[model samples]
Target chain A: MNNEKVWTAGLVVIGDEILSGRTADKNIAQIASWLQVQGIRLAEVRVVADDMDAIAGAVNALRTAYDYLFTTGGIGPTHDDITVDAIAAALGVDVVIHPQARAMLEDYYKDKPGGLNDARLRMARVPDGADLIPNAMSGAPGIRHGNIFLMAGVPAITAQMLHGLTGQLEGGAPLMVETVGCWTAESEVAEILREVEKAHEGCQIGSYPFFREGRTGANFVIRSTSRDVLESAVDTLCEALAETGRDFTPGGI
Target chain B: MNNEKVWTAGLVVIGDEILSGRTADKNIAQIASWLQVQGIRLAEVRVVADDMDAIAGAVNALRTAYDYLFTTGGIGPTHDDITVDAIAAALGVDVVIHPQARAMLEDYYKDKPGGLNDARLRMARVPDGADLIPNAMSGAPGIRHGNIFLMAGVPAITAQMLHGLTGQLEGGAPLMVETVGCWTAESEVAEILREVEKAHEGCQIGSYPFFREGRTGANFVIRSTSRDVLESAVDTLCEALAETGRDFTPGGI
Candidate 1:
């Protein structure tokens, strides 16, 4: 099954705006997709408020539980930006202004108004003994402490930080996925799905049901580390659906 | 500060699709917004996979930490729809087919093609001694085991379940919000934000920065339980912004 070598990561989304429903979170999906491309499974996610205690607690728990931990939000240049401080507290380290980050901020803002003031300088702070993750989209760079990555809350900036980190992480085999769509209700083929999945040793199937255009249907997504196993599972599932006289589509509806 | 009566709820988003980044989660925003209207703060969130142990662990942890715990996903009519069973395991209760749920399913599916088959009947299973949260969008009712609610993963179905349970939960004072947008960089007014927030009792200010139209701006959201306090804080922030000679907008940019 090759489950022994699977790499997992956990994400901590730090913000009150998300928990308050004021901002719809885009980082979860963005980071999850990014982790998949890295062959790292995103095992869990915790969205906490801006409170120092909350952020520290989540960071401590997630960082220990997974191979990698990623956090987004509360890294801006305002009073509410406390992610660096909270993460430092979690790691039991001192918060220090990185020389490279300070240099970058200085060069970027020297021509702008309010040139590298105290508030702007806050963006250069990082946990002690941490390296910088280049932010090509903004002047403030992302922070990386050991296996934990601290990123921006803004989706675009986070994307740039993630792009900077591409191919830098060690990962196991990437998961292969195959999809099959059935026009019939999933309940009618629940037993078939289970039996097909059981027959495949290394594959898992997820059924996502949807009601659209006055009809109900579902897409079965089969994922496995082995592409051959995933393909075999899909073939069995399609054969079972055909045996049940249910009309099915190959990819999805 | 009216903190004594503040109500809280935790959400456990149960879906592999969400963790896999195949589907962007809508339940967190929907449930968070709904809880806010009910005057209950959405305190924390955990997005877990479809595995039984993962779901049960999150359910137990969240249900104990907050006044209410809501789970979305894995409550459909398929083999992967194992939320009812997982909740039962978490609660140390036996999984039983509720008579009322079964009757509802029969009535709903009588005119449909699959007339309440075994796979379809899986939706009627619930943790022992639990009640049902009506689902107007689908036949499968949401499960309510004490303060733990198991809802459908589909956004529309989850919304329907949430709608059915609205106004049924007890909560404290709803938070009131007032926002002021400033054309200046948030770093330039970081001191102002910190000072204004410190002056206002029971009020918090959050700065959200954005870059648009070749200019950097930020929206400051002031929140408090008391409307008078919120308005006063807004007035102080606006006055401070004016004092800085920065052009400001009333609502947001």
Candidate 2:
């Protein structure tokens, strides 16, 4: 078992569209998956509206609780874009325009209409003592203040931000995952799943049940830092499902 | 402006799958939309792992901050389904098997291959002093302890649970919404958005920018509790966009 200190990150998703159900959130999954690849666990996520108090409260709580904290949304060029200001308040620092960010925006928006106006210049604002996370997809760059990363609400731009940050942070061994599917009710095989997880130290299994085509099925997801332990758990789960006369498949259905 | 009380809710999403990015959650949006229809505001949301302390901490924090609290995931028959125990710990209640829940499960699984075994019976367990939220999709009914709702993680099952409880919780006026789209950069209309929002007194306008078909566009979403205020804000926003000579569309692009 790997006894290394686990690095964890928390995410704050700021948007009224998401809270109002107008936009389905994609950043949680995107960042969570990206964090797994970075060997840092996505510890917690808080989705708040575009209110300064709400954003600052969540930012302060999460940034202190986890090793890294990331926020998405409210970073655009409109009046509703207050993520930078709110984050600056949370960090107890003043918002300032980074020279590099201003230069990048000036160059990127040079040929475009409404070139670098006050509204567009809002993109250059960041918390004091922060660096920029380049957004190859858009002109506006993401802001990184210490361990806090403020990203765009748009999934594609956030992807670019994650790309800019790939493998930049220190991390432990990347967690490995393996999934097995069974054409039986999870309740019928709950004991099998528990026993397998208990037998393997430092491994956890998750059971997701689904109803499709008038039948109930479940996918047992096995995860561990060690590939050997994860694979062994999957094999044990499959054998148990086979012995119980339930058809099973590896890598999920 | 409607000065009446604003009903609010907080959600706790519990799952390692969500944190691991294996599952993009649907419950937050579903519950948020449902709360809107019920005239309650979805104030904040926290997504935590399957750990006991994590679940309890979020459950306790959210259950107090809002008029109501909802939790999704870990209410199954698997070893990882510790939501019941965690909620009980948070509420300082004992875990007890509800007679009605057990009866419902027994009848539901009577003719099945495994008829209400110990693992399957786990569904009947609930915190003492809690009531069951009927799950029309599955036999395992959701547990409701006062204002804290413990729902299934599965989207469809949670939908059924919501359907069963609709029109039951007391809420204020249902929030109204109007959306306008423009085939222009939001930065070009940022002043229009801010001015309109300020004039409306109670309405909020959110600008969502997107890049599509090699051009940038934006959708301005106006939300308010008063129908007249919302419509007036929308009309003013459309007029402003029209004056700018930007092609604008009602109901979004």
Instruction: State the TM-score of the second chain for every model.
Output: 0.97, 0.99
Give the clash count for model 2. 0
**Backbone atom clashes (below 3 Å) for every candidate:** 0, 0
TM value for model 1: 0.98
Task: Find the candidate with the highest TM-score and give its number.
Answer: 2
Native-vs-model 1 lDDT?
0.92
Q: After superposing candidate 2, which stretches have Cα over 4 Å from the reference?
A: none
- Provide per-model DockQ scores: 0.85, 0.90
Q: List the residue pairs that clash in candidate 2.
A: none
Give one digit per residue, the lDDT tens place, for model 1 in B1-253. 5656889999999988999999999999999999988999999999999889998998899999999999999988888888898989999999999999999999999998879999999999999999999987778999998998888899999899999999999998888877799888888899999999999888889999888998888899998989888988999888988987888999888
- The sequence of per-residue lDDT tens digits that candidate 2 reaches over residues B5-105 is 99999999999999999999999999999999999999999999999999999999999899999999999998999999999999999999999999999
Give per-residue lDDT, candidate 1, residue B138.
Answer: 79
- Taken over the whole model, the C-alpha lDDT of each candidate is 0.92, 0.93
lDDT of 2 at B42: 95
